[model samples]
Target chain A: MGEKKFAIIGCQHNHIEIFIEQMYQLGYSCAGIFEEHDRTLAAVIAEKYEIPLVENKLSLLGETIEIVGCASMNHEKIDVIELCEQYGKSIMVDKPAVVNQDGLARLEVIIERNRIKVGMLLTERFHPAIYTLKQYINQGKLGELVHIGMRKPHKLNASSRPAWFFNKEQCGGILIDLLIHDYDLLRWFTGKEIKSSAGLVGKSVLPEHPTFYNTVNVQVELDDGLLTQLYADWHTPSKSWTWGDGRIFVTGTKGFAELRLSGDPLLGSSTPIMLYASEEEEWSKVDLIQPHATITADFLSFIKGEASLLTHEELIKASRAVLDADAAVLYKLIPSSKESEPHV
Target chain B: MGEKKFAIIGCQHNHIEIFIEQMYQLGYSCAGIFEEHDRTLAAVIAEKYEIPLVENKLSLLGETIEIVGCASMNHEKIDVIELCEQYGKSIMVDKPAVVNQDGLARLEVIIERNRIKVGMLLTERFHPAIYTLKQYINQGKLGELVHIGMRKPHKLNASSRPAWFFNKEQCGGILIDLLIHDYDLLRWFTGKEIKSSAGLVGKSVLPEHPTFYNTVNVQVELDDGLLTQLYADWHTPSKSWTWGDGRIFVTGTKGFAELRLSGDPLLGSSTPIMLYASEEEEWSKVDLIQPHATITADFLSFIKGEASLLTHEELIKASRAVLDADAAVLYKLIPSSKESEPHV
Candidate 1:
């Protein structure tokens, strides 16, 4: 990559730091950052990276930047992407790049009209445990995949969150905002398209935020009849050793494997990949080979017309899958008595 | 707890051993054991308990036996229970005491007509981790439970299992056979009744057993709007150190907890109760207080019309739950192309 540069179009979410850090790792300079509203972390990031904080986002997008990184509020991400596409710049943003079905439709039209690469920060794909699990799947350590179960429970810092964070119109529901990573993992590991899906969302806590669902579960049936179940919640206890207790349990024809993406409490900070194959007498922890190729590098390579490990299609497919799941929410549960009444 | 004596009416499943062993633990004698077909395990149990291997089941039932233990094939279990009920003998049997909805209806009628105490061995209730987790929940360590996720993956041991085990009509599907434990745990931990549930079953492996489903997933909505997800399969690798890699993750309003019922690979044989409470600084492994009272003791007490820790109601409820789930299986998959073809 020669003289690669990217500009931050929005910094509403802390996930923007992922893009910034990855860009710097790949020797790409940030031309400038533009956050319409003042965010403490954005300022911290700007000072750390020594990048100018621009007052106007369009001016930053107009820079001779190859990519526009976005971590805006869920609803505002579309405007950033559209502006980047108009400027002939590729884009990278956090998952659920589009909040709802309407935004997804608009995204489809933008991709149809533009040739620039667009990707989401599905950071789980870059985790060492994920890389190892993929290698095991590829090597047939686990025979034809049968099912995958994922649990992603994150701490919800209610007091620290912005007011708009609780609005479904702005933040999207938990399924799209949180479970998109699980959908992407399901597709990537099984190498199959989602044939059908059913979802349920509930607000067990945060009674004040009626529009925001704190608990969500989705079931996906793949084209080849492989099954996947994902449960995501913003219920990680404040005192959790890790931000989340994320896990992936894969069952195959001949064996099974478990990948603890966030460190397991029993195992401390180590991300352990536990495999129990039909040929092995006991479960063995596979040593991870830390991945050198970051998603940012791959996205930048794809933008610069070079070989890339990541593909543009899966990103869109994952987004579409999650949007469909969000749309497919079977039950809009009433917080107290779900048994007698489920309204819309 | 006088000279109580129990007879094994049919000893097809190895789980009969639990009843016999526990009866002996509580100082009850086994009057006799009657197996229509010679099973190695039945013979082993007869030898271990020093019980007579009777030629006729009726003769054994007539031998002043207060309790009749049945671990017969899934379909045959109902016949044994019915005979025991006819003889006015209290019963303790393996889970899914009755297989299908028809059998479940029969069970409800039997329970209404007979005063004999009947219980299924949901032995998970006796697990150390389960006991500890229940304590935490009851003590409000995890304040108002929000959601529960369970994974129960067991080794199929296909060749070792009986021919009838491969027949769905005889053995019940994976959900009924394996996930009854999960349903029972869900009710036990949440202290909430299941309001509505949806289930999906698929067979990704074991192609030859067309009648059986090897994979199952169920989403349950509780009365208080608490959600639960359960995934169970008959796909545990033969060489796995443990029979299953069972896990229960509980999310509550104030905190979260994880119970590794079958020891985690990383934690080895020690079952760990991990809690991340908002009041604590970090995740703490709770010390388990091993229960002196076993499921067998509770059943014996219930049969004797004495105070019992176990209830007669939850057993029927769990059976009803699993049967409803089995009946509620939405898609009858076509194995290869679930996308184009969902037969049911």
Candidate 2:
């Protein structure tokens, strides 16, 4: 196999650093980098990872460079995506890919015109616990999946964040930012699109971030009759053991499964996936290979002519569904009342 | 104090028997029982508990019977409350106290005119873990309470449940029948009235229970800024460890507290309250007295002219708040979108 060269554009988001490291681990290193307006992030990447920085986006788009990894601010993602498509390089970008319908529509044209593949890394899926969770679901060990509970609490280091990070116009809201992970996984795990949803939003914790909702609780119904709840927060206190406090509880017909994506908050340490099947009397942990590296390997294989995990159409559908769900909650849309109301 | 006398009316609900049993353990015994129809329930109470069945509601209202415990189909509960009020007897009834505004208005008139004491047992509160959880909150071990999560899954032995139990007009749906407990405790724990709420409901698991949602997820905001989520269902399969798979996760400024009310699903047995405090690196179990018996004792004291855990007005306010929240979910009320929605 030829060396799969890759370049980074917009290194401001944290996920970009992880993507570069994962790619490097799979016998590929950053071939070059470019950040048009500011080189601060580009300089950091160059100095820290010893990767070279190019003068512009054009200088880095090489012939053998099979993929370009983009991590611009959510509202700013379409530009990077278009630039990557212009060079005919397949793209692996951070989530939401684009924030609203306009950006999504524009990106859609770029992908179709260039016939380029655009993938979202969604590293949460690569957590060992989550990888094993999917394996169990496919094995039918968890039975008919019914409910999924998610809590993704990311620490907000106010002093370290860029001004745009706190602005909704630039970053999208909390749901589009953090919960897009849950939305993507919800469909993949349940094998259904969201049929309906409702959300409760609060700004109780961090008043300083006026554009951010520090806490959000959203409940969604999947087409396959699955009910799911996602709780996302940017207020996992400054002193917590991990940068994020994350948990996923999947309840189904045959039994229940849980994953502590970060460490076990109560135990003050990280743990693996735990499964309790219908017949089992105790929780048993599932074992797996290092998840991130495996995900990287899988991505490379997909780039190397293997069948894609997500169909091109499925990717766009998932993106649009996620945005609609976000709007349903953010717009506080009143769902048409169910005819058979539960109340007397 | 002299022996406290009690009476039971409308044996349709199972919780009535539990409340009576707990009261008996506290030196209070049922002076009489009454069931206008369905001798089956009355027969069980007479033969097993050996409490005598009365001819009518008035017959049970004796001089020494300072309190009356009423458990009827929710729609039939208001008449029982009025009967108790007519006799000037204090009332202990199942929730929701009323299913609609008309019932609530009628009950309000009786409560005001008779100035009667009406308390709900909310026995889930008696769960040992929950008792310990409240203790932690009161002690400020879990500081500045922020969120409470409830999962109440009632096992649906479909063939065993009465017809009225499946009727929304009678049982007040899943939220009223099940989530009412969480709502009552939410106020007591957070010390706030509900400010707003949103609910997502489904009838996915049990198609037969068409009138009932069977599954509900409601999120509420308290006046004090506490955010709470309640998940209630009557579709718990027969093989589950307990009739209810209940859990409460309370997160606060200082730490997080959790309770497994019915039992720990993973361990296949009951669990103690678990608390993870900020200063502590590990979770510790919180000790508490037998919760139900303690609650029973408190009800007895409040009936005997002692200080109340809640004022008479506060009790009514809590009941009304629970019903309103249920209706808010049932009617699918649209909340005005906040200028800044929580996301990312």
**Which predicted model would earn the best lDDT?**
1
Worst 10 residues of 1 chain A by lDDT: A335-344
lDDT of 1 by residue, B156-231 (tens): 7788888777888888868788888888888889778887777678765566776777778878877776667888
* Model 1: colliding residue pairs: none
Highest-TM-score candidate: 1
Which portions of model 1 miss their true places by more than 4 Å? A1-4, A270-276, A331-334, A338-344, B1-3, B270-277, B331-334, B338-344
Estimate, for each residue in A90-169, the C-alpha lDDT of model 1 and write its tens digit.
89988779887778887888888866778889888888888888888888988878789888888888888877678888
Q: What's the true lDDT of residue B195 in model 1? A: 78
- Residue-level lDDT for B188 in candidate 1: 89
